[model samples]
Target: MPVSSENKNGPYKPQPIKKVSTTTVVNPGFFAYTNLTGCQPYYCAEQVHLINNITVTALTIIIRVQKTSAATYHGVANNFWTGYINSNHTDNGSQIIYTFVLDPTQTVVASTTWYVEAQMDLYGTSQVTSADTYTVSVTGGGITNSYSGHF
Candidate 1:
Protein backbone atom coordinates (compact mmCIF):
# COMPACT_ATOMS: atom_id res chain seq x y z
CA MET A 1 0.00 0.00 0.00
CA PRO A 2 1.13 3.58 -0.64
CA VAL A 3 1.58 5.99 2.40
CA SER A 4 0.17 9.53 2.59
CA SER A 5 2.40 12.70 2.63
CA GLU A 6 1.36 13.83 6.18
CA ASN A 7 1.72 10.34 7.76
CA LYS A 8 5.49 10.09 7.01
CA ASN A 9 6.39 13.22 9.00
CA GLY A 10 8.31 11.18 11.67
CA PRO A 11 7.72 11.46 15.47
CA TYR A 12 6.26 14.51 17.13
CA LYS A 13 8.62 17.23 18.34
CA PRO A 14 8.32 18.93 21.80
CA GLN A 15 8.72 22.61 22.42
CA PRO A 16 11.83 24.18 23.97
CA ILE A 17 12.20 25.01 27.68
CA LYS A 18 11.63 28.62 28.64
CA LYS A 19 12.72 29.57 32.17
CA VAL A 20 13.95 33.05 33.01
CA SER A 21 16.27 33.50 35.98
CA THR A 22 15.70 36.44 38.29
CA THR A 23 18.66 38.51 39.54
CA THR A 24 16.99 41.40 41.27
CA VAL A 25 15.49 41.55 44.77
CA VAL A 26 13.20 44.36 45.77
CA ASN A 27 12.24 45.53 49.26
CA PRO A 28 8.58 46.33 49.98
CA GLY A 29 8.80 47.04 53.71
CA PHE A 30 11.63 47.98 56.09
CA PHE A 31 12.25 48.13 59.87
CA ALA A 32 14.82 50.33 61.53
CA TYR A 33 16.03 50.87 65.14
CA THR A 34 19.03 51.92 67.19
CA ASN A 35 21.02 49.94 69.75
CA LEU A 36 22.59 52.48 72.03
CA THR A 37 25.22 50.35 73.78
CA GLY A 38 25.47 46.64 74.29
CA CYS A 39 27.84 43.68 73.96
CA GLN A 40 26.63 41.10 71.46
CA PRO A 41 23.33 41.00 73.29
CA TYR A 42 20.40 39.19 71.82
CA TYR A 43 18.58 41.77 69.71
CA CYS A 44 14.88 41.90 70.29
CA ALA A 45 11.75 44.13 70.19
CA GLU A 46 11.66 44.24 66.39
CA GLN A 47 8.42 44.52 64.50
CA VAL A 48 7.43 43.10 61.11
CA HIS A 49 4.38 43.90 59.03
CA LEU A 50 1.74 41.33 59.81
CA ILE A 51 0.34 39.96 56.60
CA ASN A 52 -3.31 38.89 56.49
CA ASN A 53 -2.95 35.51 54.80
CA ILE A 54 0.16 34.51 56.72
CA THR A 55 -0.04 33.10 60.20
CA VAL A 56 2.68 34.77 62.25
CA THR A 57 3.17 32.06 64.85
CA ALA A 58 3.39 29.21 62.38
CA LEU A 59 6.07 30.79 60.18
CA THR A 60 9.70 31.07 61.29
CA ILE A 61 11.80 34.01 60.21
CA ILE A 62 15.05 33.17 58.44
CA ILE A 63 17.51 35.89 59.40
CA ARG A 64 20.68 37.40 57.90
CA VAL A 65 22.99 39.97 59.48
CA GLN A 66 25.31 42.50 57.85
CA LYS A 67 27.56 45.17 59.31
CA THR A 68 28.21 47.65 56.51
CA SER A 69 26.73 46.51 53.23
CA ALA A 70 23.91 44.00 52.61
CA ALA A 71 26.49 41.27 52.00
CA THR A 72 28.61 39.05 54.27
CA TYR A 73 25.98 37.75 56.70
CA HIS A 74 27.54 35.78 59.57
CA GLY A 75 25.88 36.24 62.92
CA VAL A 76 24.50 34.19 65.78
CA ALA A 77 20.93 34.15 67.06
CA ASN A 78 20.40 35.56 70.52
CA ASN A 79 16.66 35.26 71.11
CA PHE A 80 13.46 33.72 69.82
CA TRP A 81 13.57 32.65 66.17
CA THR A 82 17.30 32.44 66.59
CA GLY A 83 19.71 31.14 63.92
CA TYR A 84 23.03 31.86 62.32
CA ILE A 85 23.45 33.25 58.81
CA ASN A 86 26.20 32.30 56.36
CA SER A 87 27.14 32.52 52.68
CA ASN A 88 24.31 30.54 51.15
CA HIS A 89 21.78 31.22 48.38
CA THR A 90 23.74 34.04 46.83
CA ASP A 91 20.94 34.94 44.39
CA ASN A 92 18.31 35.59 47.08
CA GLY A 93 19.89 38.73 48.47
CA SER A 94 22.10 36.59 50.72
CA GLN A 95 19.02 35.71 52.79
CA ILE A 96 17.14 32.40 52.79
CA ILE A 97 13.41 31.85 53.31
CA TYR A 98 12.46 28.67 55.17
CA THR A 99 8.77 27.71 54.99
CA PHE A 100 7.36 25.93 57.99
CA VAL A 101 4.18 24.00 58.79
CA LEU A 102 2.31 25.89 61.44
CA ASP A 103 -0.94 25.61 63.33
CA PRO A 104 -3.60 27.99 62.08
CA THR A 105 -4.79 28.87 65.55
CA GLN A 106 -1.34 29.99 66.60
CA THR A 107 -1.30 33.71 67.20
CA VAL A 108 1.98 35.57 66.58
CA VAL A 109 2.90 38.41 68.88
CA ALA A 110 4.18 41.73 67.61
CA SER A 111 7.65 43.15 68.45
CA THR A 112 9.24 39.77 68.88
CA THR A 113 12.90 38.90 68.80
CA TRP A 114 14.62 39.90 65.61
CA TYR A 115 18.30 38.88 65.92
CA VAL A 116 20.87 38.06 68.53
CA GLU A 117 24.62 38.28 67.91
CA ALA A 118 27.75 38.76 69.93
CA GLN A 119 28.59 42.40 70.42
CA MET A 120 30.71 43.33 67.41
CA ASP A 121 33.42 45.93 67.67
CA LEU A 122 32.08 49.13 66.18
CA TYR A 123 35.34 51.09 66.21
CA GLY A 124 36.89 48.92 63.54
CA THR A 125 36.96 50.61 60.16
CA SER A 126 37.46 47.46 58.18
CA GLN A 127 33.83 46.29 57.80
CA VAL A 128 31.98 48.26 60.50
CA THR A 129 31.20 51.88 60.98
CA SER A 130 31.15 53.94 64.18
CA ALA A 131 27.59 52.94 65.00
CA ASP A 132 27.86 49.42 63.56
CA THR A 133 24.42 49.25 62.01
CA TYR A 134 23.48 45.57 61.91
CA THR A 135 20.78 44.77 59.44
CA VAL A 136 18.47 41.80 59.94
CA SER A 137 16.30 41.01 56.96
CA VAL A 138 13.78 38.43 55.67
CA THR A 139 11.80 37.88 52.44
CA GLY A 140 8.46 36.08 52.22
CA GLY A 141 4.80 36.42 51.21
CA GLY A 142 5.75 38.78 48.40
CA ILE A 143 7.27 41.12 50.96
CA THR A 144 10.86 42.00 51.86
CA ASN A 145 11.58 43.27 55.38
CA SER A 146 14.75 44.49 57.07
CA TYR A 147 15.66 45.69 60.56
CA SER A 148 18.67 47.94 61.14
CA GLY A 149 20.24 48.69 64.52
CA HIS A 150 23.47 50.29 65.69
CA PHE A 151 25.20 48.50 68.53
Candidate 2:
Protein backbone atom coordinates (compact mmCIF):
# COMPACT_ATOMS: atom_id res chain seq x y z
CA MET A 1 0.00 0.00 0.00
CA PRO A 2 1.13 3.57 -0.73
CA VAL A 3 1.96 5.72 2.32
CA SER A 4 0.84 9.29 2.85
CA SER A 5 3.29 12.06 1.97
CA GLU A 6 3.18 13.39 5.54
CA ASN A 7 4.43 10.02 6.86
CA LYS A 8 7.61 10.12 4.71
CA ASN A 9 10.93 11.25 6.16
CA GLY A 10 13.24 13.98 4.84
CA PRO A 11 15.62 13.73 1.89
CA TYR A 12 18.81 11.67 1.80
CA LYS A 13 21.73 12.89 3.90
CA PRO A 14 25.05 14.07 2.43
CA GLN A 15 28.65 13.97 3.66
CA PRO A 16 30.42 16.96 5.19
CA ILE A 17 33.71 18.68 4.34
CA LYS A 18 36.70 18.17 6.62
CA LYS A 19 39.79 20.27 7.50
CA VAL A 20 43.30 18.79 7.90
CA SER A 21 46.95 19.85 8.39
CA THR A 22 50.55 18.49 8.51
CA THR A 23 54.04 19.36 9.90
CA THR A 24 57.74 18.42 9.60
CA VAL A 25 60.83 18.75 11.87
CA VAL A 26 64.64 18.56 11.74
CA ASN A 27 65.75 18.15 15.31
CA PRO A 28 69.37 18.33 16.43
CA GLY A 29 69.88 14.69 17.40
CA PHE A 30 66.97 13.27 15.38
CA PHE A 31 67.17 12.71 11.62
CA ALA A 32 70.24 14.96 11.65
CA TYR A 33 73.13 12.66 12.48
CA THR A 34 74.32 9.31 11.15
CA ASN A 35 72.94 7.21 14.00
CA LEU A 36 69.33 7.80 12.75
CA THR A 37 68.20 7.66 16.38
CA GLY A 38 65.61 10.47 16.76
CA CYS A 39 61.87 10.85 16.13
CA GLN A 40 59.39 13.36 14.62
CA PRO A 41 55.67 13.62 15.25
CA TYR A 42 52.71 14.58 13.00
CA TYR A 43 49.29 15.86 14.07
CA CYS A 44 45.77 16.10 12.54
CA ALA A 45 42.55 17.55 14.01
CA GLU A 46 38.86 17.88 12.99
CA GLN A 47 35.72 19.53 14.41
CA VAL A 48 32.17 20.39 13.47
CA HIS A 49 32.06 24.05 12.49
CA LEU A 50 28.37 23.98 11.64
CA ILE A 51 25.49 22.75 13.80
CA ASN A 52 24.19 19.17 13.93
CA ASN A 53 23.44 19.42 10.24
CA ILE A 54 26.42 17.34 9.06
CA THR A 55 28.72 14.58 10.32
CA VAL A 56 32.24 13.48 9.27
CA THR A 57 32.88 9.84 8.42
CA ALA A 58 36.35 9.55 6.88
CA LEU A 59 39.72 11.36 6.62
CA THR A 60 43.03 10.96 4.79
CA ILE A 61 46.40 12.73 5.08
CA ILE A 62 49.10 13.00 2.37
CA ILE A 63 52.66 14.02 3.16
CA ARG A 64 55.60 14.77 0.86
CA VAL A 65 59.28 14.89 1.79
CA GLN A 66 61.92 16.40 -0.51
CA LYS A 67 65.66 16.39 -0.13
CA THR A 68 67.58 19.62 -0.79
CA SER A 69 71.08 18.28 -0.90
CA ALA A 70 72.53 15.88 -3.50
CA ALA A 71 75.33 14.80 -1.19
CA THR A 72 76.05 11.06 -1.33
CA TYR A 73 75.49 10.59 2.39
CA HIS A 74 72.25 12.52 2.22
CA GLY A 75 71.07 10.61 -0.84
CA VAL A 76 71.92 7.31 0.76
CA ALA A 77 70.18 8.19 4.01
CA ASN A 78 67.02 9.46 2.31
CA ASN A 79 66.35 5.95 0.98
CA PHE A 80 67.44 4.26 4.22
CA TRP A 81 64.95 5.98 6.59
CA THR A 82 61.13 6.03 6.46
CA GLY A 83 58.41 8.58 7.34
CA TYR A 84 55.26 8.20 9.45
CA ILE A 85 52.09 10.12 10.47
CA ASN A 86 50.42 10.10 13.92
CA SER A 87 46.98 11.37 14.88
CA ASN A 88 44.72 11.21 17.94
CA HIS A 89 41.61 11.68 15.79
CA THR A 90 39.38 8.63 15.59
CA ASP A 91 38.84 7.05 12.20
CA ASN A 92 35.32 6.79 10.82
CA GLY A 93 36.14 3.99 8.33
CA SER A 94 38.34 6.18 6.09
CA GLN A 95 41.63 5.15 4.54
CA ILE A 96 44.89 7.04 5.13
CA ILE A 97 46.44 8.18 1.83
CA TYR A 98 50.03 7.98 2.91
CA THR A 99 52.40 7.90 5.93
CA PHE A 100 56.23 8.00 5.98
CA VAL A 101 59.01 7.79 8.55
CA LEU A 102 61.85 10.28 8.83
CA ASP A 103 65.20 9.48 7.23
CA PRO A 104 68.34 9.75 9.38
CA THR A 105 70.97 9.71 6.65
CA GLN A 106 69.74 12.97 5.11
CA THR A 107 71.88 16.05 5.74
CA VAL A 108 70.85 19.13 7.71
CA VAL A 109 70.54 21.06 4.44
CA ALA A 110 67.69 18.83 3.38
CA SER A 111 64.34 20.65 3.39
CA THR A 112 61.20 18.72 4.27
CA THR A 113 57.52 19.63 4.57
CA TRP A 114 54.25 17.70 4.76
CA TYR A 115 51.05 18.23 2.74
CA VAL A 116 47.83 16.80 4.19
CA GLU A 117 44.29 16.53 2.76
CA ALA A 118 41.17 15.04 4.34
CA GLN A 119 37.70 13.87 3.23
CA MET A 120 34.65 13.59 5.45
CA ASP A 121 31.58 11.55 4.71
CA LEU A 122 29.39 13.75 6.74
CA TYR A 123 29.86 19.46 7.17
CA GLY A 124 32.59 19.39 9.68
CA THR A 125 35.36 21.83 10.42
CA SER A 126 38.89 22.06 11.49
CA GLN A 127 50.60 22.43 12.87
CA VAL A 128 54.08 22.39 12.14
CA THR A 129 57.85 21.93 12.77
CA SER A 130 61.30 22.76 11.29
CA ALA A 131 60.19 26.26 10.40
CA ASP A 132 57.31 24.87 8.32
CA THR A 133 53.64 25.73 7.98
CA TYR A 134 50.54 23.52 7.68
CA THR A 135 48.35 23.65 4.57
CA VAL A 136 44.77 22.41 4.67
CA SER A 137 42.34 21.50 1.88
CA VAL A 138 38.67 20.59 2.30
CA THR A 139 36.53 18.61 -0.12
CA GLY A 140 32.83 17.60 -0.18
CA GLY A 141 29.39 18.70 -1.35
CA GLY A 142 27.99 22.21 -1.96
CA ILE A 143 29.12 22.82 -5.57
CA THR A 144 32.07 20.43 -5.13
CA ASN A 145 34.27 23.22 -3.75
CA SER A 146 37.80 23.41 -2.39
CA TYR A 147 39.71 25.89 -0.16
CA SER A 148 43.31 26.27 1.00
CA GLY A 149 44.54 27.92 4.22
CA HIS A 150 47.66 28.18 6.33
CA PHE A 151 48.17 27.66 10.08
In order of appearance, the predictions have TM-scores of 0.29, 0.19
**lDDT (tens digit, per residue) of candidate 1 on 74-99:** 32223333232222222254332222
Q: List the residue pairs that clash in candidate 1.
A: 40-118, 40-119, 78-116
Highest-scoring model, lDDT: 1
Q: Weakest 10 consecutive residues, lDDT, candidate 2?
A: 29-38
Model 2 TM-score on a 0 to 1 scale: 0.19
lDDT of 2 by residue, 26-145 (tens): 112111101111112222321111111212111122222111111011111122113432332222232222222222232212233222222222112111212212222222222112
Q: Which stretches of candidate 1 lie over 4 Å from their true place?
A: 1-30, 39-77, 81-111, 120-131, 145-151
- Winning model by TM-score: 1
Worst 10 residues of 1 by lDDT: 1-10
Candidate 2 runs further than 4 Å off = 1-54, 57-60, 69-137, 140-143, 149-151
